[model samples]
Target: MWSGPRNLSTAMMYSFAGRGDCAVWDEPFYAAYLKATGIAHPMADQVISAGIADPARVANACLGAIPDGKPLFYQKHMTLHMIAGFDRSFMAGLTNVFLIRHPARVIASYSKKREAPTLADIGFVQQAELFDQVADRLGAAPLVVDSADIRATPRETLGRLCAALGIPFAEGMLRWPAGPKPYDGPWAPHWYNAVHASTGFDEPEGPLPTLPDAYRALSDRALSYYERLAALRL
Candidate 1:
């Protein structure tokens, strides 16, 4: 999933990986690099660094690391992590799909969690720019889900997403047993609460994920970037 932050990318992953035929890998590259090297990311002070330590090295390792399975293989990836010296040739062959939601909600959700680099905190416009680059290269317009859409029409929206990706839809993709996956090491506390709450892809409740007051202006800029892409989809 690609966005400034807090766009429910991992939850989306959990949704897809729930399917019977999917061999889901969560943030595999991060751990591989961490095990291979001990270098710190720029935000190492705030975020725990794990996986393959070097971005380029991590990309190389991913070339053949995707799981082999009868079902689909689900890779829940972060765009910022992918472009850090990633192997474009390998990525070019991927069934690459972008997942996005409003920047305000994303940043707000991060703020609510007290996470760093909230959309406003990390320069959301730049992150959205990066997301655009990824979508263009993939030639597939992003899945472009809104938080509201997930809350309102999860099965229908996800069914459309699966159809677009040429995967057979299944009820299993609606939800899964939550808590920790093998590959989810550091992100559990910060991002897993909502994911764990799912008893099977229930519709979103309450309001959409929110943005921080501090990042509202940046969220506007970020949303502009998203709006441009949305124009194409429309």
Candidate 2:
């Protein structure tokens, strides 16, 4: 699963983790991205220390055997983390799914966690690029599902997604035990409170949150990229 932050990604991770047959990995390339870019994030030092900083090793691990000999491996990836130097050749071997939320919602929720996000920080452009890459390689558009659709109708939305991926939709994915999971990355404490406090997808969002002018502008810029994938969502 590929997504930007605050886009229900953790909840979706938990959803997949709830399926006993699937093994989940949280943001495997994060440490490598941070190490390569030197951008400061909340808990940057601890994240780098706890994670593998070598992108090559991370890529290899991504293609390696599924942990615990599980039938399915669900890797939760941050689109922005695949920065310039990281090779994307590994993605061709995996089933790439893009998860999208409205940019206004993303900016409003993300700004509260870490202030003043830029275009790259929010990842709309990167996600669209990645989608195109996968589509070109496969000769078809890859799978995409909107966070809003998931929130509004999880069973139907995820059922369609599971069918596309050639997997059965397990009922267990609809809910999970509240609180943190053993598989969360080191940076979870800084960013996963809302998801950790929940047992399942939250209520469908109300009207898009009102943003200040600067953030509104950023959201406007991101909307086109979001719409492109959204139009193709399952």
Candidate no. 1 TM-score: 0.76
- Find the 10 residues in a row with the least total lDDT in model 2: 84-93
lDDT, model 1: 0.58
For model 1, residues 1-234, the per-residue Cα lDDT tens digits are: 444345666777777766767766666555543333444433342233444555566456555555753346677665545433445555655665655666666666666566445343433454455546667785655555554566568888777777877887888767677567664546566656876766565556565444456576656667776676455431
Candidate 2 local lDDT, 47-161, one digit each (tens): 9999999999999999999999999999999999999889999997899999999999999999999999999999999999999999999999999999999999999999999
- lDDT (CA) per prediction: 0.58, 0.95
Q: Count clashes in each candidate, considering only residues at least 3 apart in sequence or on different chains.
A: 16, 0
Q: Name the lDDT value of residue 105 in candidate 1.
A: 65
After aligning candidate 2 to the native by TM-score, how far in Å is the CA of 95 from where it should be?
Answer: 0.6
Query: Candidates' TM-scores?
Result: 0.76, 0.99
